[model samples]
Target: MEKKEAFLQQLSKENQKAQYHVMNLMESFRAINSTLELDEVLKKIMHFALNIVETAEAGYIQMYDESLNKLIIKTYVGFNENISHFKVNIGESITGKVFEDGCFRLITTRKEIYDSMSDLSKENFDFIDKAHHNNQKIKSILSVPVSFGAKRIGVMTFHCFDIEDGLSETDLLLLQSFASQAAIALHNAQLYTEVHKSLDEVTHLSQRLKETNALLEKRTYIHNHLTELSVQKKGLKAIIIEMNKLMDRNLVYADYLEGNYVPQHIKHFAKSLDDIFFLFTSKTKPAYVSICDTVQIDCYIYPIRSGSVLLGCLAVEGSSPLSQLDKLIIEQGAPILSLEIMKLRSQTEIMYKKTYETYHHFLKIKNPQQAEITAKELGIHHHYFLQTALIELDGNVDLHSLENDALLLLKHLKEKITLENSLLFSYNNKITLFSSARDAVSEAYITKIIESSIKWWNERFSVVARAGISTGHYYPGQAEENHLKAEKALLHLKKQKKKGILHYRDIGISRLFLQHPPEEINSFLRETFSLLWTGQEKKDDLLHTLFTYVQNNRSMTSTAKELHIHANTLYHRIKKIEDILDMDFSHFEDYLKVQLAVYLYKTFFGSLTKAGKLM
Candidate 1:
């Protein structure tokens, strides 16, 4: 009876211990499910698991990381913070094996856990072993898979310091039950986290959609504004003012063709506007926008162009970068601006043609009544002293280019002389300009004007040209006489072998040659140089030497210098001339006759032969 009682007492002690564990398990279930916090729930689960397995001193809950494909320690107790970040791959370590196999592992001895670790895990294990606090060491391990329904979520591991107190089968079973509850709580917490994240993402996307709609509306407004600006039928100033107001900036505009400024009420931005002009005229791009530096705030420049020709530019001063909409508006406005420039150009050209026709009529008419009518239409004062000039370009240039250059020169003349009563036209490869000054204007003043025009032509065309000015002051009806005199003066100036301005009065005795018939002049030249004209080659050399000799006042040395030949060569030529003519050098009569013949040949018949000797 005593043996049976002792056995019954021992069974009672075992039953009481089992009942205490059941109560602890119930308390753990309540504590772990108290909150939906995954981290807190996991911590409670680990604490309860270690409590139920009384001898275990350290533990950790490792959840499966789908992204890393590894088991990462989420909650831990009795381990250093660095160890809490430990990670294990599937089938790699004790916790990884339980997660991968979805089963419980009760390692009763240190050797069992160490033998199951891979070479990689052994290294990690050594690191974790050294990190144990208070000189404690891991002797046993019990790892159980934490699952929700059929899916395993993670592994809960418990570690002991003494082999004698290592985990038993009962401990593994109790921990597995705790893991089931932990898994459900962890899965619920995960779902809650993902739902909250999705809601935040939706909120962010909605805000972005609102912002994009507002931006689209703004873009539409700018497009409509630009379209309206493009359709307005008005002058360039009105258009540019509207553009300036739309852009909300200080705008300065120029029309290169008209030489007019927009906003006629504002002060001229002369210095600042130069940059815009230079860029527009120099650059070849059809449209361009660039940052420009100026006296005020820096600005953006948009060149106004049609095709390849630049009409002008619109300069806007502001403190912001030009947006795409701003650039588009400027580009669209360019055509409108170009149209205005072309219209102004056409009107000016028409006015110039009318004036040119009136002047032509004035030059052709003889009677005062007709001349007065044409002059009045041409806007020329009948009593003003009018002078005619003819400019002849000396080159083998293209006819079209020549005419264009001539027109440019005429424009420059009007600008330089600041004269409004000037008429210019191209006829017979010559640019003819008729300019009028007041009766009080001096001949010297008129000569200065002609000189300035010639100088301007030289600087612009980089070519040799000559201008002939009429000397006789005439009324409107006498334009024909003045124009004839200017032409005669130009012909005489060519024989002098000099370029630049020449006046009719300077021709002097050449006017007498002009009075005689061409046949009479030819006969005079032939009789004067009869002997030298016998042979073509010898005649050319002798006549040229004689002309140079006479031009230098019959001095042999000066003649040689002028001809760029040696004095001996000049002397030989002179001797040849004397022999050919059979005339004595000592006779003044013979020298006078030859010099007069040379002068007559040069004045009238120089253009007919190469050497200016009548054939």
Candidate 2:
């Protein structure tokens, strides 16, 4: 009777435990479904799963991570370790196998079900083996996959005390109910997470839009300031021109050529156009007025007129200094600047038209041959001159100055050459005058003219100058040749060597020889006639002495005189020269050949020896 009573008590206790767990699960499902808050729902689901199931130390409501493609522990209760941070792939563990198979699993130990293997045989058996190694001996473990609608998100796991008999079908049914409730809670949490993320992105976009608008507003403000400055610059120019007129009227007579009109006021006022507007409006002003120390500004004011009917005053300004040049620009630009304001039929012409007319006239030349005829009319021959010289000025060749210079050179050359045959024309950017040898002046006479011309050119203007002359006969084509020679002579003057006048005929033998130096001849001789000297090797020495003798002029007497020896002593040197060169010294033809060879050797080789030493 006692044994039977103990068995009945154990059965009743198990039945009551099952009823109590079911009651709590119903209550949790009711509470979670009522509260739409994902956090509260998940908390209640975990409590029911852990307390009602009365399983192992831990229980969780988890979901699958779509991005990582793994199961992630979401919320848990009764877990002392960080199981929420742990991960398992979809088909890799006992829970993963349940999710993959779309069914629940109840295993006491892997050894019991090894022969009844399913498609999850590999990982399921591996987990059972791992559990055995961990001293979870023959323990009953339950896994139920959670689903929301058609999506299986995760699994709910329950581990029980290791017992010989594993969990029954009834145990799996309770865990499946828990997994279903857990799925609903996890779905709500993910939706809430996505909504919060979208709100944060919207907030960031709004801030960026505000920053872009602020930048555009700043740019608009700066543009307005620049527009204001342009208006003020025009107003300032008018004021400056009006002041200049006033100063000109009040102090022009007293100051004579100089004026007491201080440019400081004008400069400061121009600077203020860029500086003052920022105070009037709260916008930062742009740097509109650029003042350089090396530059000068000038202004003019004139009344706009339509056939003498005056309109408002107009102001003109420029960067050039307030000189006659700026005055000329105004005399040229002012009327054109007023043409639109003026009446169409007004008698007053446009300044640009007048400027064009003036330049057109200046560039126009009439009767170029008149200068040559003027010389001929002065009783000088106009053609077939033996020799001529050309003179040209240096630095800043202004047309008006060159014209005046040509006229002056023609007058001076007439006095020197005393011939009416020369020609003076502005050609090759210089004042070129052609004078025959009869009309050719001395270098001193030419030098005096150049000095005077330079002084004249520098009056009220400062520039250095050089002049050059050519040595050649004057003809129609000789103008170009003379000009080139003058330029070459000018280049020579830049070296500070010879100056005043130069003639091509006056170029010394040294310069002529330098033109075709001996090295070129040496190269030719080495290429063409090298055998003539290379055989005995004495040919070089004999040539050297022969050149030395001819340079002293084939005179045995003077050659000996310079060599500091008797005539017979020098003859001994000369007689050996003919033998080594294999040429006759006595025959006139051979003498001429030897003379040419010596002349060529001396001219091309510079010195018979490389330096001026005897070989």
Candidate 3:
């Protein structure tokens, strides 16, 4: 009786020990697997297995890389560097034997007998032959398949130095089970690595695309501005030519003032405004315009008053109505051209402004120092101001207009705030205004002014404006930080259904959570709601009532008022929520589920109302 009791106790103890080891193994795996680095995790796993099993001399692990289409030697211990690079195909080595058989293979310690008998490569055989001849103690080894589900990912090999040491079949089976868990962990680690790499690449690509878009938008704006200037000049040239003909004073019909319209009196009016207009247009005919066949013989015309005109135009098919834009061009040109001609000065200011705009727009840069220097050289002093402003427009917002606003603010503020240096630029879809201030009080005042300016601009443009401002930059890098904070603040206000300006430090977490992220929350609710609704029939009415209640802010009184029923009746309808979900309303978990279901129903199924209600 005593012997039988002792055996029973021994069996129970072994079972308990096995369970404890399994749990420990699981815990260790979970702890190490939190790292996304695949190679480091695998090496640690192999080292753990080696320590736990207490293998002698050496341990090696091999993994199959699908990308390289090769079996790679990943981790090795107790091996010389010279032998570490050894490799073999899937069907080639003694290691390959277990992979093919899907079981463990054990080699006994009969060195002399096996050296001449083992089916190993000549190089490997020679090494074993030398060891055996030298009477070294490499006695036994084991190789086993590491698998998950049905797929074998790799093989684990261990060697023992003592002559009589070889693992039993039971030992091999236990190792195989551990190997399976290792396969799963390694697979997960690799997947995580790939996901993070893809995300990094995507982020890099998005930044590049944004930069390219900004450059393109800037160029378009410059092009439009240049076109407008040319049209204005053309209109003035026409008006001056007409006025000169009426005055008829020693009419020197300058070809530069009227392109390709040389009159028979060309020699007489060679030095006239008409000649100058023709020369300018002939010299700088825009790249877009192509000279189609001439429609008429040219006639010389001279300007009575003039400015720096871009091109000259003569009447082609008279008595036709001018386009609205053409009329606008002519109206703006008359006064400017007349002033320039009378003042006898080149319109260099306009030219300088156009060039500056083109250069900056063509090059959308984070650092505007180069542009600012060039502008200063051309007599346009730029100031820096730090502001975070949101631009709301049609889906196709005019990026060029936004950039122009930035430039105007920079120029205006530079003149207004002379004591402090200020700059304005755009980044990440927001206008950033950076500046230096004498004190915090001045900075706060500047922020208020900027907020008001943004609101005024938005109203003029018919769009919503949200802005945030930083205290003038404390330092260089601090400006960017302030800009980022301001952007975050704007985002916070947008989330909380608050419009206008917000300071970053003032945004609260509750406001952030309230922002309806219909995408993620809706998906979560849909999944949970579907799971709950799977085994129900009359629960649709309960779902509808719950959604309506939550939409009305979970007020039973309001729900009853809307439903034309007693508050108790509304309470009873909510009570039915627990019965349908097979959960008690008293439990926090059930209440959370009910709330989630209501949100999901509204977010996902609310749109079906357009097709005439959920029912």
Candidate 4:
């Protein structure tokens, strides 16, 4: 009867325990469902798991962190020490193994736990050591897979300090049910977190897009405004000023000039900012440069170019660095500036050509009515005394290169002379500048201009130029005569192998001799040098040596030096010439006659030969 009473008491205790477990599970469901927050739900799940499993002294919930590719302890309860810092790989420790196998792990003794962990790597062993140091000794353990559907999320582990019959079968089953509910709750919480994060990202992206659209609108407005400014054809200065106003900044522009027109404002600015323009023009493209030391301003320099031709440079100066929009404006403005520059250059060239034509007509036309009309069109008075300068290049320079050099020289001369009465033009491969003088221009002053021009040309193009100046002032109608006089003087100077400048008055008797008829002059040359004028191989040598010897005042040594020949060769040639002519060289009359014939031959016959009329 006592055994039957004891059995009834044991059955009543079991019933009471079952009822408590049912109540605890119901409470756990309500607690886990209370919030969708992942951390809170995980913590509640871990709390309920530790409470329902009475043998467990501590418990932890680990979640798979996709980014870390590891199972990290998300929440834990019941331990006197913290093991929240622990992490597990997918298939590494007991928890990892349970997660990997998607099943439950039961270790009934300390030896079983040690055996299970013995094969683990040093990192896992360190984790166990840390737990041991925390006084959370693990004598028994039960790790169950926390999964949703077929996807294993992580592992839920419970630890005990004392070894006992591992969890009972009913307890294991209840823990698995708890794990399923935890898994569902944690999965829902994770979905809610991801959706919320996605919504926040979408909101942030929308704000950025709006800002981008507004910026684009601003750029478009600026671009359209610049386009409108470009179409007005208000000139470069006006366009640049408008651009500066639009940017609300001061911009200093300077051009390299290069025989092109430069506005007066640009010239003044260039003078003020000479050092900056020099440094900026040296660059081959658009760039940002620091001119703080030179001009005390930060500026951006953009080269105004037209396909390898650097038209000029546009410099924008300010106290602050240029923004990307400012840079874009300059970039867009460069081509427009280039087009305007090219247009202005074309107009200037056209005006120059028209002026040249008028001057040419005034010199060539003999009709008084036509001459007066052209002179008026040329903006020149008939009474102005004009002096002409004829510039000729001496080399095998091409026509195009010569024209370019002449244009540059003319520009420099105009700048230096700065006379309103001067007109410069390129005509027949020569640069001619006609200067008006109330009285005769001093020979010294004209000489100075010629010498300075020669030096300038040599420094620029590494070439020599000879200029012929008419000696005296003349009426505008006598321009042709003065032009002819200058041409004769130039021809005389060239025959004399003179350089720099030559005046009509300096040619002496050659001026009168050059005016003689070409036929009479050729006849005189042939008659005087009958023997030497023959087209023989040695005739040229004999005549050349004779001329050189006479030119050196009959000094054989000086003649040899000038001709770059030995004195003995010159002596032999002189003797041979005397023999050929059958004349006495020591006679003064004979030598004087030969010298006069040599001068005439070069002055007249040489001119005809150059014109391809005489052999």
Candidate 5:
């Protein structure tokens, strides 16, 4: 009778426990279905699933992140572990195993949880110990995958720290029941989230399309406006003015051809024009630069480049930022402006080419009257003095750019020094400049003027040239004669291993020496030193001493160094030559003879070799 009574009592207690769990399960279903909010649904699912095991202290739900391809902890309750950012790969941890196979797992022993942690660098079993409720040991965890049909969503887990035996199979079954309902709520909430995102994106794209169409219309208007300006044949300044009007700002068209501002002749108030000019010369990229410290305005500098040539720039001044349309206008107008610049350069080059051909024809004329008449036809005054130059370009100068260099140089010389009618041209790597002066200008004066202009050119441009200037002649007919003299002078200068401006008349008496026969040169040398050679010294040594003395301008120290002799010896030799020749050293006539004799000796017989050792 006693055994039966004990069995009946135990059965009643078990029935009451079943009724309590059933009541909680029904409440959980109602709560999970109440909201489509994924967070609230996850929270309610975790809350009711933990209720199925009263000993389970804390738990967390981990959602599978498709982007990260990992199970990331999304929500947690009843735990001090801020493991919201915790992540696990599929088939990695207990929760990962549940997510992979869509099954329920119960982790009871601490070693079971620690054994699942994988890493060569560390034993991550401490991580679970620290991450659990109150940083206490995890006695057990019941993990079950929450899935919507065949697609697994997340891992639903319940933690039990106080119970040593932890959760059983019955506990796993209750968690599965909770996850089944939770998956439906999560699926509905995910669809709701995705729909809202798609709506926002659509709105954003619509607004962007509207803005893009407006920008396109602005660009079209700019294109037509620039084309009309081009067709109207208005100058490049017209484009600048139109842009300034369109943008409502002060802008300048940096006319590279004219090399200055050409925007309707309006004087710029901003002082950074020079600064903008510096930037344009150095950099080719379009940019905004704070051009001036005093003005505190950012200048918009747009470089116009054709290949590697920086033609110029469109510089706009103001502190305000330019609109997209303003930038587009500059971008569209830069190419048109570049074409205009190229057109202007082409026209100028054509004009120069015609002038070059005509000048070439003028140079070829032999008749004095015909050449003078030709000079007049080419705009040179018939009565004006003619200054001619024959320049040999240096080897380093690029041959392709010689014509361009000549164009600039001749233009400068003509404007600065020549009368209204001057003809100049470059051909065959030699620059010939023949310009008529208004009056009879001295060749020395003409040379000075050319030197000044060349100095200016050298400072600003890459020009390596050696030029020789002929004596100015009043007749334009003497052009051919003067060209020969300039060429002779240039040849003499080049033979001297030198570079610079040389005057034809300054080539000295070497011309006289070269024209004379060797017999006459030797005769003059013997006549000049005959009386001194009658003495004890050898003729060549005496000649060497006298030549070195005269070559050093009679300086005893310099003469000794040139002859490699003592100063006292050179002085005694010079005195002996002066005494023996009966020649007065003070007379210009005697000094003249000695200077000419040195020239004659060098020209006919070359330098006389030393026949005796130095004293």
Candidate 6:
């Protein structure tokens, strides 16, 4: 009966200890895996390992360092600093052998512990022995492999020094189970680290993608807005206004042909370019124009062109550099602006063609009633008397270039004529202006309009032109008559080979000569200016002298002064002229005949000079 009781007590004590160990191990596992840090995991594993097992007096945990091919002691309890420096190769010591074999080891005696070490590791053992210095002599040892799979991680070891039955099967099993948990904890830490790193990368990429998508959406919006503006048929002025609003900056469209800007308010940008018309046509790219001299500004210039033909340029002004989005705005806006310009130009050409037809039709209509109806149709009422001014470009200019100039001049003149109540049209090499003369004083106003336009056109557009105005205002019945007077004045001004405004009243009896046929004019010029017709070397000089003498009203002293020559020199020139003409200038009839011939020759402006022989 006593033996049975003792056996029952022993069995019950074992069950209680096993339950304690299992409960302690479960708690330790929860603590061990709480963090992902390798170093912290090692500390918790060592702490919980010692706490869970009663037999273990001192303990250590080692991790495999593949580079050193060694099991390095990482954490310990009841050991000196010398243990940290203690390293073991595979199968070198008890710890190494357990790691290498992936099995548990039981060193029940000190001799077994010494024999478990290889000869190569004797120095390491001696060093550890010396550190102990006979303090708490080591008796029994238990070592277990820390492994997750087939791969060995490290070794966990415990010792019971000089205690009979202090370590047992339960201790070995518990230690082995703890070693497995340590391996699992280490691996979980590594996996946790990798997951967090991957998450950070994904988050960064997502932010960048979001920003990129936003920028793309903004670009699409700007492009569509520009396209819609063009589709709506808004003109250049509307484009500039919207561009200024969109960019929140100053923008202007430069019209090279017109030598002006669309919005006259900001036309000062004209000076920003030295010459964008020629400069931008060739570049065909966006560039910076430094306008630092006057306003301390840096404007971005995007050249607007139609193939090789430079229409103009679009200018954005700012002291700061343009953003990529702003530059994109310019790029998209430029093409739409080009289309608008081309549309306006096409519309302008069609309108000019229609106006030219109207001009010719009204000038040719002779019936008063029909003229009045046509004039009313053209917004020319009966209350307004009309005067005409004719502009004839140089005969040698390119017809295409001249036509372009005439279109540009028409716009320029229309601006000047706005308040003056005048209208104008351009033909092949001519631009004609007609002003509504409310009274006699308005004729001079009409002359002033043509003169100012000619002066401005010649200066700005590099076009040379001569203009002639009518001598009288005409109602609708005499529209043809007024146009003739202006035409005759221009022809006479052309024969003078001058650049200025000439009124028909100022041109003398040259109008009478124009009434004759071209052949008659040619015949008359050939016979009268006969020396000039024969290609005499002094023909030009003689003709110039005779014309000057005629202009001086046939006064010998005044002619001498006007010719910048001595009276004797004038006499000799007159004598030479008389010799060439086979006539004397002393008789009034002879002087009168010579004067008429001279005037006729000076005022003949027709095809009679195609040969370039006669004056």
* Candidate that would win on TM-score: 5
What digit string (tens of lDDT, one per residue) describes model 5 on residues 1-615? Answer: 999999999999989988877888889888888987777877787788778877788888899899999888778887555465467778876777888888787778877755654431132345455576557777777788889999999988877777666788777777677778888888988887788789999999999999999989988888799879988988777877787777756667764434467564324434555456545655778887775464465667788866555566777775567878788888888888888777776776677678768876777897888987887788777654667777665545455445445544665666666444555655645667666666654545667877787666555554456788876656655677777777777776565545667777887866444345567767777788776545444755776677777777878888788778888888788777787777766799998888877766564445644652221
> What tens-digit string does per-residue lDDT give for candidate 3 at 1-615?
999999999999999977876775776577557676888877877776765455445667877767865456787775654344555456555666666667776766656425523566666545433433234455677777777778878888776665545545645665676777778877788789889899999999999899778756644554454446455664534444543443323222233222234233433223333334434332433111222233322332213233223323322222334433333333343344445343322343354356545434423434556545543443334434333333222212355434333433333333444323544433323444544555567567767666666565455433355665444434322334555566566655554444467776565543343455757666666565553344344555565566667667767888788667788887887776656556675678876776666644443344322221343
Q: After the best TM-score superposition of candidate 2, give how far the Cα of residue 58 lies from its true spot, in angstroms.
A: 3.0
RMSD of each: 14.5, 18.5, 33.3, 13.1, 10.3, 19.1
TM-score of each: 0.46, 0.36, 0.32, 0.49, 0.67, 0.50
Tens-place lDDT per residue, model 6, 1-615, is 999999999999999988998899999999998999878998999899888767788888888998999988888887777778788888877777788888788867776666666454666886566545356666788888888888888888887875745777878888878878889998787678779888988998999899889878977998888777778877677876777777756777777567667565243455655455546645777888765455566677787766654667777776578877777677778888878877877787788689779977987888999988887666676655678888877745457656655666676677767533555777777887766667877777667877987887666544578888885656776777877888888877766677878888887777776557767866766677776555655666676777778878879999788768899988898899888888788888878887877666655542223233343
Model 5: residues >4 Å from true position, as ranges?
1-58, 76-85, 118-135, 161-163, 166-170, 264-283, 292-297, 318-321, 382-385, 389-433, 438-471, 480-615
Off by over 4 Å in 4: 1-20, 43-62, 65-89, 108-140, 158-172, 201-209, 237-615
What TM-score does model 5 achieve against the real structure?
0.67
TM-score of 4: 0.49
Model 5 weakest 10-residue run by lDDT: 118-127
- Highest lDDT model number: 6
- Model 4, 268-374: lDDT tens per residue? 34444545444543356666655444444455667776554455677665436777667656766677778887787677667778777778778997776776666
Worst 10 residues of 4 by lDDT: 606-615
- Which pairs clash in model 5? 379-421, 380-421
**Each model's C-alpha lDDT?**
0.71, 0.51, 0.53, 0.71, 0.71, 0.75
Better of 3 and 5 by lDDT: 5
Model 1, C-alpha of 304: deviation from truth (Å): 3.8
Model 1, position 281: C-alpha lDDT score: 53
lDDT of 5 at 35: 83
Question: Taking the tens digit of each residue's C-alpha lDDT, what string does model 1 give over 478-569?
Answer: 88888888888787666555678888888888887755777887888877777776667767767767877876888988989877889999
Steric clash count of candidate 3: 28
**Model 1 off-target regions past 4 Å?**
1-232, 264-282, 286-310, 316-321, 390-447, 453-468, 484-551, 560-570, 576-615
Q: Tell me the spans in candidate 6 whose CA falls farther than 4 Å from its real position.
A: 1-251, 255-294, 303-312, 319-333, 392-404, 418-422, 425-430, 471-473, 513-580, 587-593, 596-615
